[model samples]
Target: MCAASLPDTATFPFETAVVAGVGLIGGSVALGLRQRLLARRVIGYDANPEVLREAQALGVVDEIRTSPGEWLRAADLVVLASPMRTLSPLARDLAPFLSPAALVTDVGSVKSGITAEMEALGVRQFVAGHPMAGSERGGVTHARAALLENAVWVLTPGDHTPLTALSRARTLVEALGAAPVVMPPDAHDALVATISHLPYLASLALTHMVARDERLSLLAAGGFRDLTRVASGDPRMSRDMVVENKAALRGALARFRRQLERLEADLDDPEELLAAAAEGKRTRDSLPVVKRSLLPPKHDLVVAVPDQPNQIGAVTQALGASGVNIKDIEVLAIREEGGALRLGLESPEEVSRAAEILRAEGFEVRGRG
Candidate 1:
């Protein structure tokens, strides 16, 4: 990998960012960057003029351009947030115009094809990134500032990728309040194929199987409904994803089929099937639960408040009044004496400010170490 100079701050390296595609991922990225004050300017380019207009009107992007080539020439960073199928062609189209010093990345779920395309395009500073975050909803309208919070953003830098650009990509993800995890492109694709792509396919199949059956719809219960909920995702996006990552998805499906066959064979033997089910439960239970926030609070602040209907709201208002942005707040414990509300802030300084403000307002406050 080529090494370049590391920037002191992630935000310092990228003065301007051009986002291609104004869908959910692209819009959310632009929004996140703006929210965190990461870039000086963010321009967007989308095939659909309406989507581009919507992004600009919603403040998801600072400006809209007709072509990426026009904006990418001067951009410090170019983020491709389009569907998987468009990634390769987009890479090819943007490669010649990309600034040599600029870092290029994408939000495509599949990486191998894009990596190959980048290689063919002779793009040396490219980094493959996939943010493991999304909602059931699609488009720029559904963009959320906190969408990437606590989410794992994977970076797969190829052999020719510059170390400077890799560091920049990590810094960019951090600025968005996301954890950057590095993995090989192939491995990332294979893992996601099982955890993400395969699940979507299964959900799609489950929903279709039931919908096509005349009797199954009436018999469907909460379990079926809940399991197949993701099937309602954008059909075009889903279709593109499945077709784009066919190899990995097919391999995952084969393994899943084998497992299902094994379970079917043991179904007649209740004891064997029961043991298998127990083993599966054990494995599932052993998996660690990922916290919702990538940047969790280092310390917990416990505040004692009077047991009242609006005590929590009062405490929050006091903190806000003191210019302390509460990261999280929850009612820890409630009693007749006073209820203990825990507030999670970004840093100890914010905690101190909140505590002082709450105390000044005549509420007992304690900062937990």
Candidate 2:
């Protein structure tokens, strides 16, 4: 699921990459590609001329093209960042234009429907990928290059998917500073229905209920604001996501309804209420403490730690001596002799500094050019 240190190749992973839409997700990808020097040329295409112009002005893309076919024809990697409804038609339209060696992927939240459509359309070298990172804000103006850092980017590669094509996509994902995870399309859809799609609906419904009771607004505080955060996302995108994944959403809602009824029935049972509270606490504790990938970014430095003594501590101490801060450090692999540590820093500059310091300290460091 993880890349072996950013493809250690002489040539760039891709020659030309075209992002279909220059909105938040697409813009972020383009920014990462350009910032990491992962692609030689990165062009963007958008139907809205004004937004396209804005994206170009913001330096989100190197070039802006009016015709998708022309750019797609020249691209070796294409990312479909457009809305869900537009994905199917675009796949069919771009199928003929996409080069035989091209690898196409998407950032859509839903996957089952899109994967099936692309498979049917005969799009060459297509991989379904979804980056588990975003903001409530929309538009290229809000995009950041570090949007994919430390995020669990899921790639749904089926039996027919080419291993080399998936490797190319993973190269791009790793360059974006995100971990690539593989799964089946149907399983991905089913899982997101609970973790991704269901939560947004719950927030929307909770906000609506609060709005109906104007008195509740006066009592709304930290808890209410935190619960309704996702409800403030772009309406168009949220509507498209819920509608496209309605089948899974329906099942999630039905199960949620049963849970709600059970809670209602337990209103008079103190023991049941205590048990429910304990269960909620356990679930919350079991969940990973996810960090948002957009701000401050995440830069990693990988080093092979020697087994004996305080090698890990010595590495950190060297960086600490120079006043560099560490965000989150993960042990990538362990062995009887030692282990490989992936040190997460606040920015690319910090990554460079840490690598230099580690190398001076006689550590074999390999990460982030």
Candidate 3:
């Protein structure tokens, strides 16, 4: 059954949940569980004491442990939230102390290799999971429980993975307000390679191309910035992500190269370029109308604000007070004198309400209908 079909619960599913690697994803999971009351007590384990301390201070976790020990014996669920490369080693290190009933999972984007390694290590009740929600920023400071809200979380169970364990995973994922889709590990890796990893690599390449030319740097505007935003995310984590799934990433890269070659060959022909651009826009517009994807086919509005203090904050606060939800917000352009902010709402009603609210707050608003 899919996560949507799973019955929602008002009671805690796990008594003591241990999250090893209290980084952004890990910390978010910890915070979500505690905030939703999915776990009675959430314990954090991290290699860095500073991160554990920070997590506790931020109320991301109820308790912090320096290392995995007998404390894990009490954990009903264990989340391996470290870097992709470190997951295997970390699992092996904690294997001795993990309780037989504890359900183990990871939030890493890549799943095929680590799933195999975990199974080989004889980890009891291991299920592969990847939450398609996160920011490029890393660390507990940037972690928020809302990151998992309405996200697509994939779960890949190995051959020996029991139905009970998978059920438990789906329950937890749904409890965290994420939709869970179950698929094979290989399938999940291949899908993310093209959509997630390729985008990051493409953004990185674009940023590098612009950085090499000093004059181009100043000319880089909204479009360039929008295309390369992912390039500014945590480089270390991104490196591990692309490298961990290199086999699938290489395949994706080949497909992307073919597209680039076609574009390059047609650059001199205005008609062919226009055709490509039109088709590209059509395909982009057809993306799944979900929370993290395209935001319901873009109920977009642009607000013009002068270069003054609290301009952006005032606009958002006004919308908030009026019960208008902003699905996506972007700074289209900013100049010395003024700038434009693009906001994506859920529907035409929201868009209309938001524009009227912003106008009342003394901002020039326009919709891209």
lDDT of 1 by residue, 1-369 (tens): 001123435434458888988888899898887777777678898878999999988888888887656557788889998877887777777788888877889998888788778877887778999998888778899987688887989999887778987888999998888899998888887898898789898898888787667788887765676667778778888888878888988999999999999999999988999999999989964544344565557556888877578988898898787788877676552222226777877777777877788889999888853
In terms of lDDT, model 1 sits at 0.80
Residue 114, candidate 2: how far off, in angstroms?
1.0
Kindly give the number of clashing pairs for every candidate: 1, 0, 0
lDDT of each: 0.80, 0.81, 0.86
Expressed as tens digits, the lDDT of each residue in 86-173 for candidate 3 is 9888988898898888999999899998889888888858899999887767789999888998888999998888899899999999
Worst 10 residues of 2 by lDDT: 1-10
Give TM per candidate: 0.73, 0.73, 0.81
lDDT string for model 2 (5-73, tens) is 346453667778889888899999988887777777788887788888998888888788866565577
Greater-TM-score candidate between 2 and 3: 3
Clash pairs detected, candidate 2: none
Question: What lDDT is reached at residue 287 by model 3?
Answer: 64
